[model samples]
Target chain A: MIELLLILCIVAAIIAIESKNLLSSIISLGGVGFSLAIIMLFLSAPDVAFVQILVEVVMLIILIRATINRDVTEVKCKREFFGMIFGMALVTVLLGILLMGIQTLPEFGTALVNASAESVPAKYYIENGLAQTGSANIVTGVLLDYRAYDTLGEATVLFTAIIGAIAILRKKKTNE
Target chain B: MNILPLFVTIPLAGAFVVSLFDFIKDEKKKNISTNIFASLAGLVLLVISIKVIGSAGVYSMGKWKLPEGIVLVLDPFSGPILLITNLISFICILFSFDYMSGYNGREKYYSLFFLMVAGMNGLVLTGDIFNLYVFLEIASVASYALVGFGTMREEIEATFKYMVLSSVATAFMLLGVAFIYGFTFNLNMVSVAKALGSMEAPVGVYVALGLFIIGFSIKSALIPFHAWLPDAHPSAPAPISAMLSSVVIKTVGMYSLIRICYVVFGMNTGQVPEVLRVLGILSMMLGVLLALGQWDFKRLLAYHSVSQMGYIALGFGLGTPLGVIGGIYHLLNHSVFKSLLFLNSGAVYYRTGTRDLKEMGGLGKKMPVTGATSMIASMSIAGIPPFNGFWSKLIIIMACIKSSHPWLAFWAVLGSILTLASFLKVQRYGFLGKVKDSLRNVKEAPFMMQVSMITLALLCLAMGGLMLPGLYDLIFVPAAGIILDQAQYLKLVLGN
Candidate 1:
């Protein structure tokens, strides 16, 4: 089931990238996001899945709004066949290298018992997180208590993005 | 007191306050409040950085132990970077006091500026890889917005290009981090290093390293991955340009690259050094060659930034004690002079409303302060004796020769000489000749702007003195020592 969902995600991503119309591409992107959210659920990360779905919906709406009154068709430029071939070849090489590298990695769900896994930070967090942070949910404890600074930094990123959008899109008043 | 968290908190709180100032309605009140908040945040950070110098500690969040919690490590590596980030940011904020007035959304500008500062400070100080990525995004996103702050066509285009390229880079970096996590089951630097150090070499490690190199090379605007820099740097307002060129690339790009390569991956052995040296030389030559043809004032300086960063990369690539020192010192020196140069360009644009070098001449007579400071900056960047740039460039070249790479040294020398020639062109065309009729009435930059420029110019002059034994030991030595002896860093953070 997860494999099928993953394949669906990939297909949606390719469609999103290849679609000529901006709206359909965006909708395909939504399709990709939804499949990703479902895969997250299969992985037992329901919190991530929930957030992913919410963000995907918000993003789809935003993209739709942006496309309104704009040219829906992506302008097709002169295709550089050589460049395309070169890019594809490079991608193939990189993918091959990455796959070779991944072959040596521990299989999924088995990493916790791997030789060096005793020292992994997540193990410590899982065991002591609730006690350390007074939160029953270990994830919250990790995010809010043990790694609160990361949360702070993440908040700042969101704030910065908002400020940036406002800085870019705010209507200018002419009078001094 | 644990002042580590405050570094990220104050500017964030200040950003929040400045955003609320949007409701104040009175522009003057809004402006004053924003200024006060920015200055206060800057002042506090400046003082804290000064207070924390020469000290190193780990502040684990929520009172959790190091292995269990996110830690902010204040080591020698972070000390100089934090100091430079705060000092330059404070100066840039001062310059922006007057320089940013013409732009709309003053509050939004300050808010994003402080957030960028917060992001950089966090990036410098964070000891966790994932945490670093989050902060890196914060800084990158804020800069993307700030780069397009003008809302002009070129600015928007540049911002879009920058955003796309940077997002790709970020994606690559995240993939690399994922690989690292899969390999070591750790996100903390010390833990990852420990795990990787104890294990046999894995193919995954090399792959992760490659991704990190490509990702950070883009961030640092190194030769191959530097497409976004020249466009993005010049499109932003002057102070933002200064910040982006001077510190942003260094902190997120070079510093992280160095830390990951040396401390995390252990740089003493491998093809990494050779790759770094080759990339460095390529960037050095290409950046200067590209810079020589540019006539736009800020654009020229942007290209020079890439060229100078090459020198830093070359120094680090050597992987000797002296090489590390040279690289770190060059990083510091470049931030000072490059920022001063950008501010000088900004002042010129402020007065004459033109960045075209050909349109301005004899501005030396009218704007003596701007011209003089710019001359100082130009000389500094050109590596003339007695300025900061000369010392660092000399050390890097000397390190090159000492490392038995005379060809690299030769390339370094040629790059510097070419840099001098182009800057002489800048001096001759932009400041020395006949003033265009339209620019005849141009005045010197305003007081706040002049003060910031002068202070930075003086800093350029004074930075050479940092090579003195006492100051060198105080500042650059420990910083370089951290990278040179990766074990020391691991021990310092993990207390093994």
Candidate 2:
């Protein structure tokens, strides 16, 4: 049943992406994101759902702000629309098959559980996540405690990006 | 406290310091002072990164214990990337000293530049997925602002498009992480990898991979998701063009993709490599095809960045030892040469004030340093003998043939020739032609810029030496070992 809903959402998204008006297209994209978030929720991932909602909201705000002064129907050619639809369908079909294939796998998340259950380090997080990290959130604990180097790299990427943006966009003086 | 956190803090601090100086009345003094400070700070960072690499371990922030607090694993893998991040940043800062004089507000530029470095370093070191999301945003948001830094129509347009796509991609990744966390009831990668590894694979896991692939692909600007790059990369200042092409996309986009695939999900996911391979092929062909027609020198180089990245992806996608080694080696090689190419373009722009190939004529007679360096880079990128690019590309093609994928080998060589053809166009139109009278007075770029280009160009020459037995052990082997020892990674992270 949920698979059917996912298909519908994806199809609708494809349609929305083809909308002549940019505003409508953006809205349709939001719809697709909303449905994907719903699917995530159905998969028992409330945390993911919440974050997706936050992201979707932020995206809408940014897009609307960015496009408000511009024409909604500036330059949407039929060929481009067709190409976009073709691309979306290709993605949808590919993902559908991949998802089905994933469903057939026997030891998806189970391997982590079995391995961690026996592993001593896994027992450490299981018992003392909060005690070690001083954070009640296990997610935060795991992020901060066991894999902080990855976090550092991730943060540095952001920092570099901000700098790169400033360097690229800064205005010039009118001396000439 | 281990000094890993300082890698991020100093840059953030630098950004604020530079921004604060922007309001100063005398912009010239401000510029000079800021340049000096940024360069000094970059040197310090270079030293510090070397130190961290020498003595590596898991650094839990604020003395927090593992699993309870944020941790930073500073091992060999993090070492080289961190080293590259700092080294490239220092060179860029040095290059910017003269190049940025054309633009205004030097202090702000230096600060933001350092901030971007800091973000990349933090991203490379961080352990948790959510933190990864935050740092990804830091790098991405900063890059968006940088893409629009020019504020011209094309620049702003590209930045907006990049920003929207990237933001949406980040949303998907965050959503994926949230799902992983809620489902696994854990957040640490080792824990999550362990948890996900143990559970009967759910529908959500595939969704997570989808989210990650889309996000990282967009970040990397792979073919289908690559509309923003050609526009954005060229629109930035030349040094920034080099930085973006060489480091930003690779570190944020490719690195994240590989780390997630190998570490979080494990390479056992049957379809993931196939997906990567398909994307790799698409990017390889499409990026080169699109680049062939471009008249803009920088834009052409930008597209080639995508193509070279494709070569890297294709090798890794092959999923063999030789393939992985070739991929990583090409990755390092590509970063060096591509940055050199971009810097070479920057030198031309500094002299000619234009990126259009048609407008440039006979630059070789005037700018000897730049012309020679560009030729070296063009040869390196085209897989000419004795350069680092040749060896890596040869390895990738050989790996393909060894894997019974001769067609891929054919495509790889075809791509290299195509790359050479386009760069030949750059040399012909932009550098080797009759010297345009208007640019006759144009001189070489400032000394520092020349020095940076020369250093990279020389590296292009010496990189082939990396294949020698002694050099390979120090650098390539350990990195390759990381990819080869997938099970060992899982064990180290999740085991006794």
Candidate 3:
């Protein structure tokens, strides 16, 4: 039943994405995001659901504002609608195939639960990372202690993007 | 006095100062204040990056213990990127000193610039996935605003398009992180990798990886997702064109992709590189093919940015040591030459007031320095020997052939030839042709611009020496080593 809802939600999202009015399209996109968050919650993954909510809200607000201010015209061509339908059908078929393939997957949960439940270091650190890293957060411990270098590189990339944006966006004014 | 926090704090402080200047009544006072803050702050970042490189170790934020609180990870991999960030940032700031003189709201521009740097530095240093997202958004949002800074028709339109595409990419990334966090009950990349190591791969894990690939691919402007580059890159100023084409796409898009795909998720089941190879070949062929017909100089360069990035992807995608080395070498070379080329175009615009090569001619005699430096950049990009681009391109081609993918090498070589042909068109029309009657008296760019261009051009020559034994070990080898060892990363976190 839950799977069915997810399929329906995705179908609705595709429709929302295809909506001619920019406002409705954005709204539908938000609806899709919200429903996905709900589906994640039902799957007992509250953390994923929470992040989904945050993302959904942010995306909806930004896209709505942008589209309202956009220079949109009528979707006057039937070919575009045909292209959209063809694309959607292709996606649906691909996803259906993937869902069918999932039956072949092994029982990952039991295996992980058994393997990690035994003597993995993760069991110790999840409970005691704060004491080990001197930071109050376990998440911090993992990012900084175990893989600080990756984080560092990621940050530099962000810095580079900012510089790029600033350089690209610098403006010139003229007296009218 | 701890250096890790200073990386974030200084830029944050710089942003504040820029904003403070914006509140000032006098325009001249505001401009001077912003420039002084930006320049000094950039110099400080440069010095600090050098110092951080010298003393290589991870520093947990707020004296937090491992896996607790926020942590700032510093290592050899990050060392060169820090230097790259600070160095290019300082140069871009210097370029802005003269370039932005004609623009409005100098303080706002400076403020956003510093904030973006701060966000990026924080993102690179933070080890947690969620923190990375926050920092990514900080940088992304600032970029969106900056892209629309001009408020001109094209600039505003480009900004909107870039914002939408980027927001979707970010959403996908956040969703990926969310899935990972749910699967592992943790947001730290190392912890997640550790969890992933001992367990059978879950369906959710595959989903998360798929999301990351799509997210970062879009951000990195990989071929299919490259709609925003030409419009966005050329919409901004010349220095920005350099920043966007050279570093932004690599750092934001490619760097994150590497971190998540290689370090965090522990390789793509051996299929990820294959996917990258296909995309690389597509981008290489299509980007240049599209560029061949362009008349705008910067627009042409933007298309080539996509093409050059394809080379980097191809190298890394080969998944061999030689390929990885070649990919990274190409990355460094591309950054230097691409930025120099953009700056050269900016200089051309500064004097001639046009970006169309067709309207330009024979002012090479008048602007000897710009002319000479642009030629060096052009040759380097076109894969001429003795310049940096040649060595890296050769390595990538050889790695492909060595790996028995002669077809990939053929495509890379073909792309190089096309790149040369297009750039020659630039040379013929923009610099080497008959001097336009209207542009006869145009002057060279200001001293600072000239200095930055010449320095970068010289670096182009020097970078070829990096393929030398000791030099390779010093820089590219360590970086490549980081990617090659997936288990070491697992041990680093679990060991901690």
Candidate 3 or 1, higher DockQ: 1
* Candidate No. with top TM-score: 1
Per-model TM against the reference: 0.97, 0.81, 0.83
User: What is candidate 3's lDDT per residue for B1-496, written digit by digit as tens?
Assistant: 2688788878877876666675687878877778887899999998988777633456565554444345566655566666776677788888887777767778777777777777777777766787778777777776776766666788889988998999989998987886776566666667677777778877767777777888888887889989998898887777767877787777777777877888788783488888889888988899999999999988999999999999998998998878988988898799899999999998888878888877888868779999999999999999999999999999999999999999998899999999999889888887886777888789888998998899899999999998898878877776777777777555544444
Encode model 1's per-residue lDDT on B1-496: one tens digit a residue.
Answer: 3999899888888888888778888877778778888888899999999899889988887776666677889989889889999999999999998888777688898889888898899889988899999999999999999999999889999999999999999999999999999988888898888888899978988999999999999999999899999999999999999999999999999999998888888865568988899899999999999999999999999999999999999999999888889999999999999999999999998888889998889998899999999999999998999999999999999999998999999999999999999999999998998877888788989999999999999999999999999988988788888887888898888777
> Local error of candidate 1 at B6, Å?
1.8
| Residue B301 lDDT, candidate 1, scale 0-100 | 94
Candidate 2 chain B has its poorest 10 consecutive residues by lDDT at B487-496
* Residue B344 CA displacement from its true place in model 2, Å: 1.2
Q: How accurate locally, in lDDT, is each candidate?
A: 0.89, 0.78, 0.78
Q: Rank by DockQ, highest first.
A: 1, 2, 3
Q: Using lDDT as the measure, which candidate wins?
A: 1
Once model 1 is optimally superposed onto the true structure by TM-score, how far is the C-alpha of residue A38 displaced, in angstroms?
A: 1.5
Q: Which portion of correct inter-chain contacts appears in model 1? A: 0.82
lDDT of model 1 at position B161: 98
Model 1 bad stretches (over 4 Å): A73-79, A114-118, A173-176
Which digits, one per residue and each the tens of the lDDT, describe model 2 over residues B1-496?
A: 2688888777777776776777677978888888888988899898888787634566666664545346666655667778877878888888988888877767756766766787688778877677667777777766777666666788778888878888878887886786676467566667677777788877767777888888899889888899888988998878788889998998899888887777678863368767877888889988998999999898899999889889988888887778877887888888889989898888888877888889898898899999999999999999999999999999999999999999999999999999889889989988897998888899988899999999999989888987898867777666666665666565544345
**Sort by lDDT, best first: what order?**
1, 2, 3
